[model samples]
Target: MSGKGVLVYGEALVDIVPATEGRRAEAVLGGSGYNTALTLARCGAKVAYNASLSRDTMGKRFRVRMAEEGIDQRFVSDCDAQTPSATVESIDHDGAASYRFRLSGTAFDVAPPEPADLSDFAHLHVTSFGATLGVSGQAALALMRRAREVGLSVSYDLNIRLPVLPPPDQARSAIEERVPFCDLVKLSYDDAVAVDTGSGQDYERWFAGGLPLVLSTSGDHGADLYLASGGMISAFVPASEVVDTIGAGDSFMGAFLASLWQNGGLGPLLRDLPEEISASAMDFACRVAAETCGERGCKPPRLKPKPPYD
Candidate 1:
């Protein structure tokens, strides 16, 4: 796994949940990039995480979690600012969580890093809409550009949170700027609706413009996969008890990429992915996502000696 596997870049933060019905106030590990890296490692994919962590207590928690999960932390740097946090405001009956963040001056909001060797990784993944704003935006763009130069497959998750980003116009601009570098773009149907530059909802247009794949997931209603080659495939969500939807999309992405890697379709092969591999990966992803929805907070299931596909 030294010169192979996935390279993940983005935020690492804590989610503070207020006490609710017999539960005490608590903090949990989160952040789109953090959850995705954790899921990738648990799914048996070698993963290198590159996010700035503060020296604060929360940051220490993130470090420990990464170590316990066996994630590569070679590029996990430190910052003077405190770790960012998001306080859960409410959980609807459907188990969807809403949040309010404390991110100004936090570790992830700092200046971008100088370019480094990206030649080792097979794929690059970046998430969180907040990561597409300000300094974080610069970091994402730089990594994506560098990954492309090195021929690494790139994926972006428009995990948009209107609460933590700029206005739609600015957010759309920042987001659009980075999509051209991506081979795959994963977003919720809501995200497509929220950040539509009038074309986000037009799946065919995205492919016509060069995106190889676009996965639009809608909880319970299911997910849709559109390919640049031709056709769209719809996958149903595997039934599972809903605990919370904190990292459903992250887990889906992790499993999807893990499946592709296992089947030898993660790199150049991804551009002309076989229909069988694409369908199988989508099913594996949906299963992983449903399992995460049954957990407390982004705790993905292990896919080792035996995986769901097996």
Candidate 2:
């Protein structure tokens, strides 16, 4: 899949969210990879989504949404299996969510488009189901390996689902395999804890060795950025009118990548991007997430003009 902008590799699932307490759930087009692509395109980045899309109704809706946003769908492959979906149940007054997956293993299969198929892409963003589940996990690993060989800047999100993935010990082993392939990693505090108790020096030590950067989000507490060459940077959640937090993190990632892509640099940016440049990316990301939270569901707004740094 050749592209001018970022290519997001992962699952494109429908999010069946609760419309009213104890009432029927409304199915919405979502998934970290799809949401990231949608947000990036709306932000005016030339983006493409590479995934195995089901030919079912939900998959059709998802593809239509991508086209409507002007995101290229040439890399998407069609399948006959049922589209995977997440049945979401919100918890507490904050509207934070708990999810249960209905999986069909009907996500991306990496047989076609050989590595040479990828051309002229500025970046690759990977996350969610395709990064960890059965065939999806292998697909992600293959693409990451190819990206490495072809010299494409890469980012990953450990959007871990505890109930759906393997046991903790096994999950860590799986996660460890992909971390080294990424220049940037975005994982939530919950993911950090669920994946490896995320409080130990082990994670920092690993980052120090392989990963160039990581953004660890702590829900309402904002996020912390760890840089390989520099110390940690922090950004607090800017105050905003609260809405359900669905897709907030994905929006953060979308704006984050958008900042780096459009930043005026001809040479590779992720590996040696200046300290301030990365910090500015976080600030923009945090604002994007906050704005997404202000709206219901995962509707990421168009990227506003870049704001002055704090």
Candidate 3:
């Protein structure tokens, strides 16, 4: 886990955010999956991004950003379609963003990679629109199955949005079908309420069925970590100067995964980590998320370890 890498699979798109005090849309490298890769690379995790990239200007910007952030582009899939772009509007002064996607013509057509392509990684994480929408949906599910088959620690995030996906029941069913293979499942409370999350019962059933961990986050209320072995860790949140929480959840996911892998690979952490270590990891994730929220977009403070969580 320390030396191999974390392979992040899913959408890499541009988030066009309107300038808070202006009328123009400012483009940020968008998508939850992309942000997680970026943060992990910035944290010094050996990271590779796996998604289709277009040859368009926005795609070029995304490619450059990945390079600058130290993410490996070797697994990228090329597509003739335009790069995906999501339009996000700030609904409140807190910089909380509401997103609507423009994906039909974009390049999220990811296919599962050849086994050799993924052999170098120690862990894998997938999220966002790639887990839904038919275009890349089957590919995503296929990749997760293969990852689990290969015995990699697999993580999934249900960052689902109703506006871009199928009906709730259909979406929920797809996700549930993959739950057995995942070692960790992360969600925001809002994500839980969305299609495919199945409220808390889904999490309970997965846990009862032997899923390793279920983490549910609530902005500003801290987060909850439920273990399959029977216990819970309440991850306390640190305060920060409020800016806009554009990619807070992604930042949290990246940091949490990084921390978990650092102390022990997912298998070890799930079965053996002390409560203090688990709480410390969550606190570190919260700090990274808080710092991201202190800025306009998904910027995690240069990733560094803070004092351990008490």
For lDDT, the strongest prediction is: 1
**Residue 30 lDDT in model 3?**
68
Q: Please state the error at residue 155 of candidate 2 in Å.
A: 1.0
**Higher-lDDT candidate among 2 and 3?**
3
TM-score-superior candidate, 1 or 3:
1
> What tens digits encode model 3's per-residue C-alpha lDDT throughout 205-290?
99887687888888888898888777888876665677677888999999987776666545434545577767878888888888
lDDT of 2 at 71: 91
* Candidate 2 lDDT by residue in tens digits, 1-310: 1235788887778888777755565787888888898888877677888787788888798878888899988888777877878888664577578888877545444322323466768677889757776877787888988887778888889888887888988888887788788888788988877776455475577677677777889878888888777678888657477668888889888887776666632125677767776677778788888888886668988874253343
Model 3: what TM-score?
0.92
On lDDT, the stronger of 1 and 2 is: 1
lDDT of 1 by residue, 232-275 (tens): 87787665699888888888888888877777777777777788
Q: Model 2 clash tally?
A: 0
Full candidate order by lDDT, most accurate first = 1, 3, 2
Q: Identify the candidate with maximal TM-score.
A: 1
For model 2, what is the alpha-carbon lDDT of residue 203? 58
TM-score of each: 0.94, 0.91, 0.92
Q: How far is candidate 2 from the true structure (C-alpha RMSD, Å)?
A: 2.9
lDDT of 3 at 95: 58
Off by over 4 Å in 1: 1-3, 112-115, 197-201, 304-310
